[model samples]
Target chain A: MAQITFEDLSLSFRVRKGGKIGWKDFIVQGLRGKGQDDDWLTVNPLRNINLSITRGERVGILGNNGAGKSTMLKVLAGIYPPTVGKRTIEGTISSLFDLSLGFEYDATGWENIRYRGFLQGETPKSIEAKIDDIAEFTELGEFLDMPLRYYSAGMVVRLGFAIATSAMPEIFIVDEVLSAGDAAFQEKAKKRMNKMMDTASLVVLVSHDMSLLGEFCTRVLWMDKGRIKEDGPAKKVIAQYLEESRQQQAA
Target chain B: MTKAIAATSDYFTQIWQMRYFWLSLVIKDLRTRYRGSVIGMGWSLLHPIAMTAVFCLVYTTLFDVSLIEYAPFVLSGMTLWGFFMTVTHEASQTFLISQAYLRQNPAPLAIYPLRTTLCGSFHFLLAMLVLFVYTWVVQGFGNLTAFGYLLSSLVLLFVIGWSMACCCGILNVLFQDTQHLLQVFMQMMFYCSPVFYYPEMVEKRGMGWLVDINPFAACMELIRAPVLRSEAPEIQSVLFAGGFALVLLCTATCLLARYQRRLIFHL
Candidate 1:
């Protein structure tokens, strides 16, 4: 069974005044003797977040810009280690934040599928089994043999979506990826995602589309300023969040 | 890779499971390296061969050494030196170049260096073939009996390359300036090592201990002495190079285990 827990998780980043200062900056700082720990500011992206997610749960994270929706998903994806808390995630995790991360532009579409599979932590044997299915779903025909550089935006999106969704991940984290692809393909992609959500052990999705979240998520987390403002049934939280944000905007 | 990493055994298992990831990365490295070129991957073979030829012609004439004698010497020296140079030079970029994979996939921290080493080793093995063909044509098949020694040298060179890659990959990830500093160090190392000339010349000048003290020098002779002249490498040289790499590997492992998860912050 899939399980995820966060115990007071917090993530902080150090920003420099003049931008990413390297060794030269440190040397200059030493020579000038003007350094007093004054140029560094700690930015907290996630603040004291605590939650537990078990198998058969579909949760939607709704938040404004910089409210830590992506940060929380990244934490679960093992991209960022928490600064002052503990996290335990049990099961296979497949993150879909930036689907084209490991794609090579110069490589042919077919070669990229293998490369992408490797980056996704799938063995070659398994990826081989899924190649025909991905090829058919992408519908790229001759383009699959051609370099990805020649592919159009919609074509790339279809490829990315097909490759990412082909595997049955025990824990799936989706962040703004479903927003891509053409209309016809987007509908097809949504159907595939909904099917996966029906059977997947745990799913966490971050999106701004209210209807999509309401249609898919059983629970909702409303975040404001890096903290959860509301957590309850999907419809109730979405209703309250929508009314509060509407009133705030009107004011 | 999400398994408990406290035990030594788990480390091996995690790395083993991730072998396909590293192998595919190496293949891609070789593929994209010469994608839009006429000569293509032939450059790998042409590179060290041209360097060895030019260096041999210039240096042997300047030193008044016989072409027949110095050819084997330069061939063996540069072949091993090429491995060392390519690895140490490219090691810094191993992590920086693969930042995408590192961010997306949390496999073993060792994968970066190991992949770079495998890529370099493929080139290194190709250049070794150049040496063997040249030797067979000019020097005859007599010294081919020492082929066993060449195998040992290849193993030792790989260990040294892996160590440098590990040692440099971490530092480069933390400090972007480390790559520039490493470029300078590798240039200095190239000149100081016995790649272009004979160690006997250094010894004749009463700087004999320089070869003994310089790990690069010892590593050069590990291949040069055995494959070129068919003599056993100094036991001390093998021990010194092995011990040095072992120390670096231990340090790299410790630092990687401690800071592996934190590396994303710096990148």
Candidate 2:
């Protein structure tokens, strides 16, 4: 069985139209248009998309804003089912999408890590035994006893990263969290990810860093307008993508 | 059938994976709720006390009802009602508030709502302890045996709270106005249930059945009997309430699991 597959997946979100319709537009359309009035409303955030991911493969998804990178991650994580399509995911999975998703800011770092680690599928006994290791990795050390709200954004990212990745899963799904954090933490994160690559059966990462994509991923998936434009070796696909982007800029 | 099997396995796996997270959530929820300045968690007790005071004044002074005969009456109803209302409000919003967590881990969405309801009930245990102390000090612990009935009533309230929370939690995701709507519903229910007035106070013509259908009324009747030195609650009512709660919980769990992921888009 494949580790993950999204067949003709479609997920859309409806945002309530803000503000009253302008009177000027209403009157102008009424005068110029001949068709009946329409009350249908809402905008779709994600459209039909199809993709496949298999085991022992590191697939990297790249796309511009609103191009559906995050949406794809959510779908893969089962946070949002495809509005239309069949999805089959085999084995246990973990997500490192956003840092404050499960952590309670009002609680201490010790508490947040335990809660977050648990949410990520770590047992209490395991978490308790590894708290010191996680705490050391985060370098937040003594501050772990303090409320998370008191910590800076960098601190939050470090702790979140440590807790989430602490327990390796069969499949790990990470969003654009790498773009965050300071230089030192980023280096540490890369090193941690390198360690993960050694043990994880499959790792699906979404990042904007083409250079990093080349360094980590065996294959690259370039998404455009909710569809895969290229799915090939990291270096070749990223080079082609960059060339196309440059040409579009020039034009 | 395959989907169901897969889903069940995933649900159990999620439960195992997120057990620590849920336990931590419970602690965080309880700690944050009452961790502020003075009173601390004692305010958990204070809430029921203040509610009891309000009912005392409303029933005795305003309506000319007798508390001397009804002190236990108001205490039992309000305490149990407080537990029910608190759990309902908390559980109803559990998923909505934990959107961040839900968006990250697609495990059993039912766990979040259920965990919250359990947390709310835990606080109710504290408030129940206070009720025992208050009534004992005031009336001299007459029928300690009523503790059995009290225990059963609390369990009944837990069932109602858990079921209602699951229903409301799912509904609130679809409709943002559910919280406000529930507030109004609870207010109406407050007046409808025999919270302040005895069931006998109302003309017993056709409304007896109304009290039966109202789960809160059933809970109060059960609790009030033991506390007021009345007989044990009717076995039929207890069984009905317990059965009703179980059905609601199962239904809510199923719906939540089915719609768990879809909720992200709706939110």
Candidate 3:
């Protein structure tokens, strides 16, 4: 059983509190041994939350900016370790959170596909098998030979989306990457994502689009200020979340 | 204590599983360096060639040093020094530059340093081969036993470069001052270590302790002895190099294990 379990998982990051961060000042304070003078602010992005995600579950995370939604997804992706609890995961994980995750601007578009695919833990042979499909899907043609530095923002996103969706991942994670391309590619992207969602054992999605959540996920977690405010069926949790947002805006 | 042990073992296990990633990244790094350049792959040999010309002019011509003897001496040392410079230069920025990949997933922290070292070692091997062949044609090839010592010395230097990068790479990430500090340190080490000058020259000045104690001289003796001096490197120097390399690599591994997870926050 490929499952994700979190027991009282929490993560906090330390930040230099006094104004803007500068390496010059940090070195001076460090040399003087005045650690106290450099005020450190600890910010907990994930707090005392117990959650379990099992196989065949598509969980959508909804939250306002800085509400720990991305943090939760990142923790699930193994990008951040828990500060005060335990998290046990069983599965091969793939993240599509950043469009240019392992992209090198100096590398050609074809090269980036392999680079991104390798970063996702795909073997060279496996990625090579899908390179032709990925190339055709991106509609890049001769442009694939050019370095990514010359690629347009739309072209970069297309290349990223094409490569990310090329392989079947056991546990797929996405954050705002589906909105990468233009309207036409967006429709195609949604269709491809639906197929990936159907095939993947576990899909942990973080998105602000309520309609997308309702369409893709059966369960949704609404987070506020580092804690889950509501967790239920997608439609119901989203309804309550929108109502609260409306109330907060109106007041 | 057990927790630390567990983390260390898990760290190595994670890296072992991702061998392909580290290797491919190394290849990608090297390919990118000389990709569009005119000479292309030949660029790897250019560093040692150019340095040899300048050093040959200065030492043999200006200082009245013999061309036959000194040519091989300076060429070998400069090649090793080139490896040291390039590895440290690239290693300091390893973490900072890999921030994109690091943010995407829980990538192993050690891969970044390995990327620099592997890329550097590849270029070093190519550069050294060219230098060695050129030296052989000019002056006869040294004895076979000295070649074995040179091989071990090369291995020691490689480790020394890598371990320095590991410690400095993380420190560079945490405190930006480490990058600048490393540059100044490398410049000082270049003059302090016998890169352009002979170790015996320093020894004659009653500063034999400098060559004996310094790890760089020990590493240099491997390349210089059989290839240049045509003598086997002293066992004491070889032992000192092995011990120094062991200490450096251990410190680097321990530093990485302790702060591997916390590195993401710092990044």
Candidate 4:
């Protein structure tokens, strides 16, 4: 029973005016008093998000840049706690965002597989069991023996994707990682994702690729300014989203 | 009370469950730190040994202290101080160093500080071994029973180091100047502490209160009593060190609880 519920959730954080005040400025500000609000900007990345997601649903999120798609995904992944209201989740979650961010550049690909696998909650015995399968999927052959710093961007993405998707999680969350690799890798990645979607109890994805969403998602959520603008069948919602974007461009 | 206990136990369980992840990271840190160096891990030992040699020469020649007595004393003090310095300095950068992992996975925030402390402990233990062998060669191990107390003192120091790292790591993330501020503060502390000089020198100069209030001074006494004089650490020093460790652990826990989820945004 995989479920996710967000009830009137909102997240806001204060950003200092000059990128973090120094100790001296902090003291001066304390002494001056009262007008310190001028030195902070409150950013509301999410606001009053009310939604529920259940098992066996392949959902795609559609939004423009800074539309809170990634922020919502992060909240769903439990990376960010809401500032107001509540977020409740059940079942194990595996998120595949920022794929290229966490690799140890000094460690070789084989070592990275172990490191990333451990982070994904795989035990040593479990990782050893699946190591060969993950290695085969990446197709980097001799390159896996070399340190990650020497690998090209595309190669790193392949390794990251392969290791990340190895876990059989109850819920899968992804964010715009499919745009990086070459065409052949993309095709293979799609096949792998389709296979994962079949077994995964629920899947939530954020991508700008409407055609990809139309093909893979049963439902689509169109987000605008931290709120869900439209939620409907994949084809219908993506059509409305595309229609609005086309109208704006023509205007 | 039960709920709090359950939550605390749950937190520890989460940390225990992710042992492989953090442990592997600690090993990777240790490996990369010495990878290209010709002397490799010996570099950690050489730093304290070299400083001890220089201090021994100056003290024996100018201060008219006996080499046999002063060498082990200064060496042990330098080794302990080195551990304290390394742990706090590196801990301040722990969050930034693991920023990538923090963004990717939601492991317990304390593990990052633990990683830094474990690395520092490796060096500390290695240096302690050197001090042990040096003491045995010079004075033939004065009090065998006193050596048992070192075990408890090491545990206390480890707890203190971990807590300090946690607090410093979180503070550094919030205020980017924390590491710099800490460096200047530590410099002041080094002079205030009896790192190279005798603890009695401060007392003779009518400033025994400095030793009485200084937690580092208490720590020095804990290590020095057993290693230098072959006497068990006084109960007062032990209690002070233990009490200080508890206070810091509480502070670190509270800070982590408040900032664990929010710290990601700042990073």
Error of 3 at A149 (Å): 2.8
Model 4, position B86: C-alpha lDDT score: 73
CAPRI class of candidate 3:
medium
Q: Model 3 RMSD to the real structure?
A: 2.6
Q: i-RMS, every candidate? A: 1.9, 5.6, 2.5, 1.2
Compose the digit string of candidate 4's lDDT tens values, residues A16-133.
8789666677778899988999888999989999999888888999999999999999899888889999999998887878765678898999999999899888899999999999
- TM-scores of all predicted structures: 0.93, 0.86, 0.92, 0.97
TM-score computed on alpha carbons, candidate 4: 0.97
Tens digits of per-residue lDDT for model 2, A1-251: 32888777777655435433333545676788764245335444455556667777888888777777887888787787666788889967777877667677877898887777777667767888888989999998789989988988788888888877787677778888777788899889878877776774678889888877888889988887777778899898899889988998999
Worst 10 residues of 4 chain A by lDDT: A93-102
The best candidate in terms of lDDT? 4
Off by over 4 Å in 4: B141-144
Q: lDDT of each model, Cα atoms only?
A: 0.81, 0.75, 0.81, 0.88
| Candidate number with the higher TM-score (2 or 3) | 3
Per-candidate DockQ vs. reference: 0.59, 0.44, 0.55, 0.71
Total backbone collisions, model 4: 0
* Every candidate's chain B TM-score: 0.92, 0.84, 0.90, 0.96
Model 2 CA lDDT for position A199: 73
The better candidate by lDDT, 1 or 2, is 1
Question: Which segments of model 1 are wrong by more than 4 Å?
Answer: A24-36, B1-6
